[model samples]
Target: MKIGIIGGGSIGLLFSCYLSENHQVTLYCRTINQVNMINQCGITLQKKDSSILSNIHAKLSTERVADELVLVTVKQYHLPELLPILDKIPQHIPLLFLQNGMGHLDYLQKMKHDNILLGVVEHGALKISLSTVKHTGFGTTRVAAYKGDMQKLMAIKNTLQMSNFPFEIEANYNEMLIRKLVVNAAINPLTALLRIKNGDLLSNNYYFELLKEVFQEIIQVLCLQELEDTYFASIVSICQSTSNNYSSMLKDILEHRQTEIEGIVGVLRNKAEIQKQSVPFLQFLYTSIKGMEYKRWDE
Candidate 1:
């Protein structure tokens, strides 16, 4: 299997290293330095107990993406610029998009790919360097086809799944993404603002109160009222599992990078307005994270 990964961020590098073990993997990087470094040094995955390094092909983003499968791991904001390049890939090849929120869903409608898959990466990964990623949490990659054959998704899962790194195919893409969106909406902004690890939200009652408030608004906007309990439990489980890890949003704030607030919270607020639902908590989080991101420009 030939797999090409777009973006050299933590999630991209993590998948490149793990998938390269079984497939002919090529990592497409935006910067020449990362491509050069990955080609010379290989990609490394640092686990709690051990570190595994895998050698794989590296290429610049400008090159053609011809592969059995391609994973777009770049942040949602970067997707607009990337879509033109991805348009060149043969539509028959499956492309899996792993983004934080539902904003990327709109992008899929325009793609010509016959087999477009949507997925949420539950595992927590932190980039240590250009060629290294730390696996901060262990979780499954749940995938659902936006518009494709189920057998194709299952086949891709079977080809890509590993004992240590697992992949599961879901029946409903919207449900899978909604669950992840709830997790991100509740956990990310709280952690980013408080400058605390995810676990802190669960440990502190006051923080937990605010978390519930935010989660309720998101659920309301998405109209997941029936599964509120189930979704909240999933959020708690994720925070508990990735206790020590800083969320991608929190990391973005700390590192002075733009967070995916627009994709995650921003999208929710838009939905709220359309539905004529009141979501003060979501509105607050959307603006708050935006304010934090705006500071980057001042610095």
Candidate 2:
């Protein structure tokens, strides 16, 4: 299959590394430096055990855009900009949204990209350099087609599994997405605020309390999505699974870059307002981290 990855970050390039072995992989990069590096030397994938794999195609922009599948891994704020770029790509080609929070589907809905599939992946990777990425943890991916296209979803699932990637197809896409959002909402912000790794939250009891408060608000917001069953236990399970890793939010803050507070916390706040539900904890988190993001600009 010819695959195109829309984001040039860790997640995009890491998948390209392994999947490129059997398929034609093209990466869409925004920067000239990344484009130059990939064109010159390809991507380098470093394993947890220090093994290295390199050489994968990375394109500067979308040119000759015929792809059987496309993975949109751009940040939520970039969605508006990214969608129009995807217009050149074929309509029937399946697009998988690999983002960290809720409301991605709603935006896609407005743009009318109904061929979209939502997938929640737990695998973690960090870009150490421009074209170098380190795979930190291996976690299962759960995906489903939101537009009632079961056959195509199954085909994508089969290919992912055959590629030796850990993945599964959830019978219910909405429920699965809400569950993933809940976990991300619970863990990401506190880690970013405290400037700590995922596991470090376990070391600080105060942070655990903060996590519980956020998880409760997430649970409250998820109730609007008919996901009352996504409880604290589910959030705890994700915390334990990704214990040793630094969250994407923390990575953003440490690198002095913009964080996905909107995707992670702002979405929760938006849901609460739309549903006329009171989510004080979520509102507070949204305001706090947003302040941090701006404050970093002064620093």
Model 1 RMSD in Å is 1.1
**Model 1 alpha-carbon drift over 4 Å, by segment:** none
Clashes of 2: 0
lDDT of 2: 0.78
Compared with the true structure, what per-residue lDDT tens digits does model 2 show for residues 1-299? Answer: 88888888888878888778778888888898898898898788888667566677777665555679988877787887776677767678888888878767667775455477888877888887778888887777788787748888888878866445666888988778777777778788888877777876666798888886777677776664354454666667667777777888888888888888888788888878999989887777778788888988888
lDDT of 1: 0.91
Candidate 2 lDDT trough over 10 residues, lowest sum: 224-233
| TM-score on alpha carbons, each prediction | 0.97, 0.92
Note the Cα lDDT for every prediction shown: 0.91, 0.78
Worst 10 residues of 1 by lDDT: 237-246
Task: Count the clashes in each prediction.
Answer: 0, 0
Candidate 2 Cα errors over 4 Å, as ranges: 62-64, 111-114, 224-230
